[model samples]
Target chain A: MDISSGVTETTIKSKKTVKKQKITKGNMTPYLFILPSFILIVGFLFYPIGTVFYYSLQHYDVAAPFYNGFAGLDNFVTIFTQDKMFLPSLLNSLKWVVTEVGLQLIFGMILALLLNQTFKLRGMARAVAFIPWAISGVLASSMWSLIFNEHMGVLNDLLMKLGLINEPQAFLASTTTAFTSVILAELWRGIPFFAITLLASLQSIPVDLYEAAKVDGASRWKTFIYVILPQLKNTIVLTTLLRVVWEFNNVDLLFNLTGGGPAHSTTTLTMYIADLAVHGSNFGYGSALTVITFAILLLFAIVYLKLSRYEKE
Target chain B: MIFNNKKADKLITLYLPLSMMLCFTIFPLYWTINTAFKPEGDIIKRPLQYLPANPTIDNFVNAWTNIGFATFFKNSLIVGVATVIVVLICSTLSGYALARYQFKGKRGFMLMLLCTQFIPRAMMIIPLFIIFKNLGLISNPLSLIITYSAVEIPFTTILMSGFISGVPKELEEAAMMDGCTKLQSLRYVVFPLLLPGIVATGVFTFIYTWNEFLIALMLTNQQNKFTLPVGLASMMGEFNVNYGALAAGSVIALIPAILLFAYAQKHLVNGMGGAVKG
Candidate 1:
């Protein structure tokens, strides 16, 4: 009787402890797990974003801090009415986004479709095609710089050999060709991104749909239009929106290649802001520009998503 | 006759376009490599040698020892590895929580993560510069590491969550029923399966940190502290750039990213596709 009572008592205690453990795990474990990421993101990202707004209101030029104080609407006003570079740079940003993302999408879609087709050495071909995506913007700029170089560029040599140009043109230095050259270089790198994303979307497409289209006597072009395009709609919308934002902010190639120069012709808004932050010490004005850029991007995102109804099937 | 038509169609539609894309994709890389191996004098030699006549490693030696690319390479590696560890730890924990539990703010947290995708990375430079300056972390690798981790965590967290969700819940339950502790169950049951996802995420983060130029340029002023991209940019800005050394430096920077991509690319595509599809 004593042994049985002892065993029963210990079993009851263990059961109670298990219940307690369950309660704690259910309530606190997940929060604890999430705590580190929450802290770092909030401390670094979200907090810094808040400070951009705060600094935008004051004259916080690191070059001349003694003149810093509450400037109120002056910063925003200067950006709107007085700043000469503002409107031009904004327009340049629009042009840059349109050309870069548009061309990248078209070429990337073509590459994706081609890669989707079965052939020998497809895996190796896919790997080679996607290689440029792994390259950094700076590296791409350097590689293109070599090709666009006046003296040593293979491009100039080829163009001259083909009687296209009498002399080696300074592709990057000339204002007329600078933006286009940069676009082409960036296009080389950017196409791989779309190709990869779209290819993934393509892989997920049901094979039955294609067979059905074929059975319906659809030509390849007709099938692509009727079957493939509809399946890829969501991916296209999402990737394009993402790419628009990404390409808008992409200052790497422009910064390294042209430095937004040759009469400031290629100075997109983000590039202009980057120039301000780096070369100019006017943190306040720069922050103000940043705010405007942020608002424009947020507005664009909202309008784009609404028009596309990205959330809806 | 039917086969002949099919063959002609394939030639026009597939092989021709495919070859053009390949040339467009491969030419720059090939040119860069060709330039890297050529003697500096022959680099700009007229007739533009498609093949280097006198290939040499002098540029590589010069860039590595004298031009401070070695330092840049080391710095990039340090930042890349450290950022990967931090992102992996933080993201894995949060991913586990997101995948397994029923929490009140789960949906809100997910929405917040998605919202970060829209945050303009370029605009953050000024604020981040100030924040780092105030913290006295300018020119410090820790700042880059920490900042990169924060930048990477949301995406990685989502990725990890997707990967973790892919692991069957029943497996974990079975391990638990086998009298293993929760930690033990996870260690034995889930982690082995999650290794590929972890590796892909690490490579993705590493590549971003390695190639990041603008922020690295802002955060570090001392040349000794420069990353590969910053170093390359500075070299490009020099009045008389050594084209050979520049090409060599690029090849060095390009290797790790390309190698890592080649290794983890299959998983990366799937993981990224899954993440975006969600």
Candidate 2:
């Protein structure tokens, strides 16, 4: 026993030494492994952001001499005070976030709750429901655009065919209709996310809780209110926050479907920035706008993190 | 009595979802397919036909030839394949290290990766475009491959790490004890277990790269180099919308995504449903 114990003690000591060496080596290894990705991020994400921050203060032009003199806070002032489109675009984006994310969450939750039930062909139904998510955003926007086209749109035709309307409507030409059209397209693409995420959350809930509630003579509504809603609260909050950030930053749907058109009615911050950068050749101003957008999104992200913390407790 | 109630409850539960699934899910698809088959003039004509009165393949033919869809298809394929390859390699190595090694800052590294996803694509577009332009990579398909890989790496790594963790380390250690090198141990022991994860990640990478528009739109400026989305977008100008050809193009773009999802449906579903343990 003494001899075996002595042998085991030596093994343990050697093992500890090996572990210490391994730990140190392992620390370096992860950094080495992640080094390439870190370099890419720095090269692509960090450096450009830093450049944008710098450029935001400079008076640069895309064409006719790229270099310009320092102009601190002036560009920001121009955007905030001078640019008439800026405030309205920002408001439109805010409206988009509330409507798109809000409606997506409500509808998605309802869809998820319905899908969560055991039924024949449940898998097929779920897959069918997720088909819209499989379609690319640009394609989805284009399809909707065709459907909303003033003269050639199928929507008007369908409504007329069904006796829902008397005349063909110019959905994309009017400012109010154009904004509504963009929001609807966004919602169409976004609703699936809520359904999928909420469905996943619903699946995670144990069936025993519902069974137990039933055993206690709880009605169906009472069981859903007491058992389901409380459990889904975290998922709902997180999804809502994610949807807000995503919707706030969305560019393609509105850009493609509306072209921020009908006198720039649908031009959100992203579209505005892209317009300045790509079309207007005001890279410096665009970069400034980009920075501002990031700042706003970061603020929201911090709020979301804080809310998540509160939810955790 | 209880069994009957449960049955009735199940049926009741299915009713709303089924109706919603038909409306929100199937209607748009039906509309698209319906529009795709309609005569060019009937597409915008009043009183939308539930079924195309005069379906024709002319739009498909026009979309195929006029839009230069063949080139777009080739570009999308090359970029998608290249992204999958690069992502699989880089993510596998990083994921393996993350899963197996007891490293300092592992948690922090993961958190950092997750944080990257929150940074909006719009924020990265300008910087990425500038960086690629500086490197003289504008209009290059290879540039897109690199950018897509970079954008996809973090998620792929996270997914792979989850998968690699599920693989037993004892097998690797056992292989090592047999005088096998670390690389050999990983190749023989750990890699087989990671195949499903790699497939899942590969499918996602392919789909994302295939569907990606903004980066592809900005990066590749040449007409011949334009991917499907850009190609389709070029059809729209100040006036004269090619509804038939555009609808046809939209259907064409749907093919690869649908086929990919179909091929990897099981793994994709599993991956989406939290198979990525992290």
Candidate 3:
């Protein structure tokens, strides 16, 4: 027994020594492993972002190369003063982010709670519910467009049958209805994201917590308030912030469904930027707007993080 | 009697609301599919055919051949597959590094990754256009493949590291003690367990690449190089739209993403949950 014990102890000590040796040797393998990711990120993301700042200061229109030169803050001034779309588009972006994230979170929380319950066909139901999460923004736009189409749209057919409208309304073509219609379509896609994330967090909560709440004579609503929401605080805050960033940058649905149309009623800042990049031929001005966007987002993120105190937990 | 009441409550609280949500979620897709199967003339018939009176595959045929969805689909496939491969390799290696090593700049590297998450994707459009244009890779598949791989790497690396951390290091160490090289141990022991994570990451990247529009639109202007989303967007912009072929094109785009999501959703949800929680 002593001999065997001694042998095992020596082996363990030798293993520790090996580990120490591995660390002390200053292994290059890890750096080598991380190099490709580092290179790609630097080359594409960081380098491009850096160029946005650089280009923001220059007059770099592809159409008018003769006018191209350093234009120190001229583009920003134009955006704030000369450009009409900047302020309204910024407001639209705020509206877009708030509505999309708020509605998504509320419905998503409810969906997550429902999915968390023990039920038959739970797996299949989850798969079905998250179908929208997997569908591309463009595809979702197409699907919604088909429903919003005036002549052959099922929505028009349904509305007429209900006697809600005497004539088929062109939802996307009208400014008043276009934003809301797009929001509803995006909401269908956005909710599943929150549901999936919230459900995952929900699953991680111990059953004993619920049982403990029950033992304390807490009702279901009370239990949820006391037990569930607190546990979900971190996930909620993080996902909301992430979702805000994502939705702010999202132009797919807006671009396809409305083309920021009906007189640019649906043009968020991102959509405006996309239009400029795609068609406007004003790279310098677009870059300046993009910089402002980045600044706003950074400001929002910092303020939001401070407010949520996300790191406190 | 109390038990019966509880069952009724479950029906109302759980099944009723869930079904409604499901309807809202699935209806658009169902509507699209319904339209896709209808003949071109039947699609616009009065009272709007809830179901195609005469189901046909002609729209699919037309979309695949006439509207050039075939080329778009092939281009999307190439970009998606290539990006996924690059992301998997880069993320796996970096993830293994982060999971195993106590290296300098580790915290900084992690912060860098997190910072990338907050970088507005819209900010990349103009500069990326210039950079790629300067590189003379405008409309090239290589531009897209490179851009997407970079965009996807940060998230996938974090996810991959989480997955690798879940794999206990002791197993690999034990294999090393049993006279196997680190590479061999990883190949034999860790790789099998990491397969699900790799699949989750791959699916995530593939879906993003498949569905991405703005960058794809900006990068690839050629008709033949358009990905599915770009192609779909262009088709939507036409003066006289073909709803049948459009819906048919949508279903074609929808299938791969949905199938992949359905297949790997279990890992995806759990992995995402872990990532978000962190």
Candidate 4:
């Protein structure tokens, strides 16, 4: 934060030259190069998004396709009026995002800070620690499910051996532990992402700042407060914002693990919508929920961008 | 004394915590691998075996042959390779444009890429299903390849642009000024230096395609059409829930992703750092 920005500015002087190139000089080469991705994005990505909004207004149930037609605002009205699972699932989504991102951020920062120091075997340690980042959400859920299984679960075995319990506890079967269990499983995978990103940014901080803090006889906590955190300001804000959005929309682990669960205790808004789309065949209602979910995410994204002043980037 | 203090501090601050976290990170994987080799009886046996006593390949065999992870693996590989090819090509071209050229709507396009990150997959499921179903491509691998490429393009473009920009433009211009055509210069000069970055980007896209679940689940219904994630998921739903085979299936799914990651992770870390730095 002290002098890093000023240093990188002179380094990027060449990038400034490239940025100022004229359209006439480049001509249609860029357009031709970009056309394929543009076409695909428009056809597949943008078109699907547009239809999500469109179908949010129409009755498009796959099961009852004969009855499918213009639904107008009926789906939305019913979402607010008749959908009982909607509000609860929305709340669950919030709880999931806050808890998951919060824990991931905290632990990830700890892990990043830990690995940032020069030490023996640091490379090997970093490699091993970041391995979970490669595992998919479904695979992660399955791996954890085995560990949390009522019978033959290692946790239950350890607990019984230690005289903590008499018998196996179905951690995923009970509402109380289902949400937390999945969250723990996801954290195993999620933390590595934040750790990796934060670690990368951590490496970019200048050594001079730390040496200066040392010369001033600053304690470690004070050094972090005065020097490190300020330099990491943008990265922390951006990563946390991204993590919040990702955690909010993430449904794969929950979908596979609990299937929105023993008492719907773990059904996130996205999970609920996905359940509706995949199982209920109520495409209209699901689309409406999708719209609502997107609106929530959009609102969060806008608010977060404004708060962080990151949109300017 | 100062050196000793530093060592002690590093021990307190670094090694202990890193080791603890590493155990947490690697345990699930270890358990999966451990379970993969264990006999079914040994998996459920009393007094849990940390080591697989009488390790067997039965689970792998069962998952590959009986549980149809063979098909899943093949399908995942096909989709992943195709998506990687398309994404790398499109994103490289698009990324080069963003990096090297100035154009109208460039800011708009860049902003569009950023905006794509926030779009929920739930929103896409219904419409994508309808669109694919209408196209009679619901069970087709092409639908997955197409959708995966599109969804991935925006980010990959951003990544590729970062990579492209890191390559000095003067080098490309120098090649061009040396009486080489633009494509020729690009082929001869820029492509070599850009290979690592391209591989990094390609690996990222491949992993995404390989591990993607919801979209794959939404698009595919046929057993043969199922990707690794979808196949593993379907197996998890069985009433008895074959723990050994499931763990084995998880292992099979884990291989390509983890292997590719192990290979490309250095670039990934650097690429990621470069991205956030900008």
Candidate 1 lDDT tens digits, A1-313: 9999999999999899977865777798888999999999888889988998998999888889899999997899998999999999999999999999999999999999999999999999999999999999999999999999998989999999999999999998898999999999999999989999999999999999999999999999999998999899999999999999999999999999999988998999999999998899999999999999999999999999898894564
Per-residue lDDT value at B170 in model 3: 93
Give the better candidate number (1 or 3) by DockQ.
Answer: 3
Q: Which ranges in model 3 have alpha carbons more than 4 Å from their true place?
A: A1-16, A310-313, B1-3
Best by lDDT: 3
lDDT of 4 by residue, A188-297 (tens): 88998888988998898899999999999999899988898888888888888888888887898899889999899999898988888788898877888888888888
Global Cα RMSD, each model: 4.6, 2.8, 2.1, 5.4
- Candidate 4 residue spans exceeding 4 A from truth: A1-25, A310-313, B1-8
Q: Tell me the tens digit of each residue's lDDT in model 2 across A1-313.
A: 9999999999999899989878766757777877777676555655766888888898777674546778888889998888888888888788878899888888787887777876788777777777677778788877887778777777787788789989888887787688988888777878777888788778888989988998999998898899998887777776677778878878878778878888888888888876665567667788788888988988988988897788679
On a 0 to 1 DockQ scale, where is model 2? 0.54
What value does the interface RMSD of model 4 take? Answer: 1.0
What TM-score would every model get versus the actual structure?
0.96, 0.93, 0.97, 0.94
Where does candidate 4 chain B have its weakest 10-residue lDDT segment?
Answer: B269-278
Q: Kindly report which residue pairs in candidate 1 clash with one another.
A: none
Model 1, DockQ value? 0.77
Every candidate's DockQ is 0.77, 0.54, 0.89, 0.78
Q: Best candidate per DockQ, number?
A: 3
lDDT of 1 by residue, B176-246 (tens): 99999989999999999999899999999999999999999999999999999999999999999899999
Q: Rate the local accuracy (lDDT) of all candidates.
A: 0.93, 0.79, 0.94, 0.88
Fnat values, candidates in order: 0.78, 0.45, 0.94, 0.80
The candidate scoring highest on TM-score is 3
